[model samples]
Target: MSVTDTEATGRAPGGGAGPEPAVLTRRLRLVLVLLLTTQFMLAVDFAILNVALPVIGRGLGFPLAHLQWIGTSFALCAAGFTLLFGRVADLFGRRRLFLGGLVVLGVSSLVGGLAQSPGMLIVARVCQGLATAAVTPAALSLMTTSFPEGPLRRKALGLNGALMSSGFTTGAVLGGVLTDLLSWRWAFFINVPVALAVLVIAPRVIEESRPEKRPELDVPGAVSVTLGLLAVVFGLTQAGEQGWSSPGALLSLVAGVVLLVVFYFVERKVAAPLVPLGVLGKRSVAWGNVAGLFAFATFTSLVFPLTLYLQDVLGFSALVAGLSLGFLGLGTVTGGVTASRVIGRFGTRTTLLLGGSLQAVFTAALVCLGADRSWMWLMLFAGFAGGIGNMLAIVGFMVTATSGLADHEQGLATGLATMTQQVGITLGTPVMSAAATTAMTGSGAVAVLGGLKGAIGVNAALVLLGVLSSALFLRDDRPAALRASRRSGHGRSARRKGGGRFRPVA
Candidate 1:
């Protein structure tokens, strides 16, 4: 009875009157399938470039110094616009933006594949990131809006989180195969067919929805936050390449901090802010983001250094190194399939603790890795452990962070969720690199091996800090009301029927 405008109108059956519950449920499942497929393409887009970079540089004839732009350009644009576009989806229309983004992504992919020069390729990649920024939050908002808060949403999110994780590792292997077998251009061009399929199917499957009372755009908040995020991402990327103490990195970092502080004040004054300061004040959202930040940072930090160790220290080829990480993809898929069940039985917080604990253990285990140690253990089992841990942790973070918000603010919630991930990844590698470099032991292979151990140790510590924060600050994953319902049911069958409920916010 107290359902909001969106629940009442936007969620109305289909075009006719209203479909039966059975029919509606089926429709929702199809929608979920479409959304997850799109997510896979987006997530893989990032990783697919990794193994193809050298070929891309040669094809485009760019100087070695500028080759990084193929990837960095995408990161810069994605981190810059993700939040701003989140608000735009809420204000304009999520379905429209989501579709537009797919088109943009498709177009950019085509352009990139066909590009003849470095500048053209970089421009196309930047467009791909910009489109991804729009697509990510809009897609998440659509999923949250489509399902009620219960087993349904939990399962949906868990599966999505898994696919995203698996997509990354899978893309690494995919890129290598595509590059060696066909051409590097296929890495960019592959998105075209998938995007086209989603583009064709999405309109029929997904229903359009947006906030109830449209508000004016918060220009001040938007500009400040976007620039702040952009500066921060650029600074972190610079630090990864040029060291944190460099003048450019330091200046960008300083500017980003100043802009963000200004944005905070501006958001308070704005009639309709880009990000409500109040939403961020909530315990679950705030600490969930903190957890999400470390979850992403720690997992991503392992890839580059480990790649070096495999290829340089242990004498693996590029293709072998890339394929070895396939264990991570398997773990991610397995974790996704099981995370919702784990949450259903144990609870979100417990699952989160378990996940964080797993990640910490995985990274610490890597510290024992040596040149003589069988690559099979580290590359296969350890990679799988790390993959599952990161995926589970990510799903937990997303569920907790966005749980209590009103439907209208789901965009902002998803935006912040995406933003934390991007920022975490931006900061993760550089900080870990610094920690490892400070303790460098010897030269070439030996030095690289020793440095990686230190770096992985730092990663373990960061994840442990995340575990501490989750245990200390996050509100219980299940509300008192939901627990009461489950208690009343009191059986294996009833427990499966136990639906999630909410308590009043403090």
Candidate 2:
């Protein structure tokens, strides 16, 4: 039998063992459940603390200037460490790193729950970010490896995307309820039990896979990229607070750009680069990542300003604000579930264009809201539309980005995509914040409303840019070899199923 035939038969070359029995299917389901649970927990942490921020600031006596750091700290650490951990996953086992990350996440949550000062909380949040850095890429790699590329993979990816989008919106609502009924501390504490459960179950349920050959960690490349991203994110954030022309902010921004340029060159020369240049060479992958980054950035900006607007301008309680954001989650779920169908009918290009255009329209509408506007339903609709856009754009982008990669490179591909998202959020948040603040120079509610409008307008424009990039740069053609390989693999499997006769099953 040919190599393809062996693979098709789902047996060893010597036919030593056949496929597992029905009991293994049950085990596979359990594995999927555990993985999804961990993913949900990670996603929730990304947004859960947003709803609790005001309360945390009030409780800890954090100044307005420093309040943003509560979120930034986590985001920055996660962004900084993602690439490094991706490399680590390539060296060590992804499962080992994933389980270890869960432990760190649980422990950090416990510490964060007990934090008495903003400093300690920031440290704990950073730790949680580090844990996430490890968990997310590994989880994605695991998913790709466990499920073969086809309808099964598409379904899994769609569900994963839904979990991710829903987690953010759900976090806001849950954070509010937890903060109001219990304490803001519970927001952090809640992760303890969830993380514990994931840690215990993941090892047994999730299959362990290692890189084909252990790859050397590109320490210098990692450091340079980390510093570059950190510098840029810090500068943007400072510009929001210290003025865009400030010497400190300008210098940081310039330095970040230079460092990133250097890092790019370094990747080209390194034997085992942090991110393979070949991956970026693929136009679909490159454009897809860029679209994902911009879309996510718009989202990052929307969350902070919207939360503030509800509380400060509309006088909504945290819980009410959180509940309002649930519309976004519902929309996200709707989009995620429906995207595969949309893609099947319309292809990725049209789906992205439509999603992006709708998102831009709704995001712009958010700017028109006011204290007297009793259009709560309008707010919900806008959020839902934006969620739909996000789901279509994100899932399409991811599918395109890693479309033709080898199984071993899956971790690296997932890492680069995730890193882009973090960078987008890091950059987008501060820029939008600054825009809003600048728009609200006066003290009245009208001034606040104006500033928020400006911010939302900026986000809308960014979404439009993402749409243009996707439409212009993303290619529609699948590599002919990849398509052939898939067809051959499927044919061989069918033949094997018929006991060496080319009889079709089902």
Candidate 3:
């Protein structure tokens, strides 16, 4: 068998002793559950704190202005350290790093739950962010490695995407309920048990993965990229609060851009760059990330305005508002499960276009929202539609990004895919909030409604741009030989199974 055949069949090159098919299948299922649960926990953390922010501020004596830092600190560290840790995981050991990350996340959540001062909570959040940076890529790499790129991989990724989306929405709901019933601290405490369970179970189920040839760390590349991302996330956070033209935002953004450029140059010169320039050359890696960025930016941003509309205009309590979004969460689940089949039938590109279009249309429907009670059902319908479309786009983008990469390179690909997603999530709300804030005409609820409509319109437009990028630039660029080998493997597998095969690219 050729190298391609070994990969396509998910078997040893020489038919050496391996686990029985039934045993292997069961193990894969266990691994998927473990990884997907972790993904959900991390995703929940992203939004859980947001709903509890005001309460936390009051409890910790945080000033109104500094409250955003509680969230920003996590985003900053998570985005900054993600790529470096991604490479570290690939070189060191994925399972080892994954376990370490879970420990960090648990400890941080404990500290956060027990925090007495604003500074302490903020510090804990930063640690949690760092933990997330470590866990996400490592977990993603594990999934890609455990499941060969075919129906199984697509199905795993689809569920991963669904849980990720739903988890964030679910976090909003849980945040409200936990805060109202127990305390805001429970929001932080909830993660501890989940992390502990995973830590105990993960080592037994997940085998470690590392590159066959370990290279020396690219210390310079790591420092530059990490700092550059930090600066960028800081600048974006500042832009959301202060105007983009403010001196601090301006300086941070410029410094970030320059540092990123420097990192690019460093990569070109280094023997073993943290992110190999060659990986970026793949069409899937480049364009797929672009699609992922927009998919997240629009979908995540839409939530902010919707939350505001519910609380400010519709006179809903935070808990009520969060509960109402149950429809949105359900839609994401539906879309995520449906995407794998869609990809198998129409391919990732078509899925991308279809998802983006539907997302835009649903988002645009929000423009009709009003202060009347009649608008509630429309809001739910639009949220459901938007959620479905958003998940489909995200899953398609991830599948596209990770496809056509070698097992060793899966870490880098997932890291890049995940980094873009974090950046998009970080970017979306601030930009949309800034736009809405600027469009606000007065201090009344009416003014807020107008601003929200404008933001939703901007959200629709951004998603449309994502669709255009997909239509114009995205294409399957896998090597012909690799593609041929995959087709042959699929043919044999399908024949043996009597007819179920998944083809995700044209």
Candidate 4:
């Protein structure tokens, strides 16, 4: 049977819904491309403006302190609303939310590109974040639902992971190129075209999906969780830029923690909780998210200190410093593409162990860096190797995290994973930056070098902890869903049997 025909009929080659055919049809291939492209766009946007922050600030006449809002505004909104949007997609429709997010992204990017004032630009960024928050979970949930759990799904996710990592690497380069050649505004303008294109094509290619029976929206739970997340993320940003003891950081942290505590109680009492907290009890889901958090924390945090080593200590230009990251990017792409094969051969636990161990080793090796320019070769090698290991672990974490749930829970699963990832990314920079700052005891390149080494050491320590945790906790590779399906005789029956655990409220 043709792949497109199988997909169109919503059946396997043997006929009538069961496991998906273990082949990639042209139509399904197209869908994968479309979804993967969406993933790449989101990842790219995360880093695209980072390089252009200075240019954006000067163009909009932003005060030096306020310039951070360019990035923070987007991060805060995206991280805060991700969980809520993920569940919303499950209850409403993934395709609908995905398309809406694209429209919002395009419009916001256009406004950002045309902004005449810092406030206008910041507002646009906030909108852009909200758009991202919507699209990321929706697109990911769609990907999970579109491909059944098998090699095809593994391959798709590997590519998804690849695109995500590569997109970030590519964004830094593209941002630098666009900012230097055309304008910093091009970073925002660039997303407009991609968003517009995706908006036009996605409807034709993607299937619309939502739960069969919808539940009333969880308003109080959503508000509490969203506000809590926003406060925590804002506090982390503040703590990184200012000291942890700074009033802004301390107050935000305290408030966020309190709100989160309230959310926990609210979830327990609510008839229809936004997130079924029980999902966290699953070993794969809980441990997988922890793996994801550390993977991002280590990988993302390393860039900052490395940049300092390259530019401040070694006296490389900003462009050169950015370009130097190509080594790591190349490694990331290479790792992402090959991850599925490794997982398919070794299974998730082994893959996680291998990836984490390598990442920790390479991250620790970064201590070799100093004022000497000749050490660039070692740095490049370490970065490239580290990228491969990090992506492998990341893909494994994602695969593990989403493996056990019923269809209805996939959205929540992906949302949880994505949320942890954002949190990790947010936490890494500040923690590493603080470590670097604290370790600096002297002046000039020597002091900067000492700080960089200290940060790397701290990150290496964190990665080692991740490696240990995975070794201890990630004991199985078999998915709970597959086992349940085996016992029930079909995927649908398994879901039906298990669905009662999270029944919707009237």
- Summarize candidate 3's per-residue lDDT along 21-46 as a digit string, tens digits: 32335557778999999999999999
TM-score of each: 0.91, 0.85, 0.91, 0.92
Count of steric clashes across candidates, in order = 0, 0, 0, 0
lDDT of 2 by residue, 1-506 (tens): 11221233233434244452222255556656777788888888888887678889999888877888887788777887787786677678888988999899999999999999988998999999999999988887777656555444555666777788789778878887888789999999999999888777776656566765687888789989889877887787677668788998899999999999999999999999988888888887788888889877887568877877787788887777888777888888888888766765555667778788888999988877867648676788899988888888777776766667766677887888778777776777678878887788788777787888888888999899999988788865444544574667965775678887765339
Over all chains combined, what TM-score does candidate 4 have?
Answer: 0.92
Highest TM-score against the true fold, candidate: 4
Global fold similarity of model 1 (TM-score): 0.91
Against the unseen true structure, what C-alpha lDDT does each candidate score? Answer: 0.84, 0.78, 0.88, 0.87
Q: Candidate 1: minimum summed lDDT over ten consecutive residues — where?
A: 15-24
Please identify which of the two predictions, 2 or 3, would achieve the higher TM-score against the true structure.
3
Q: What pairs collide in candidate 4?
A: none
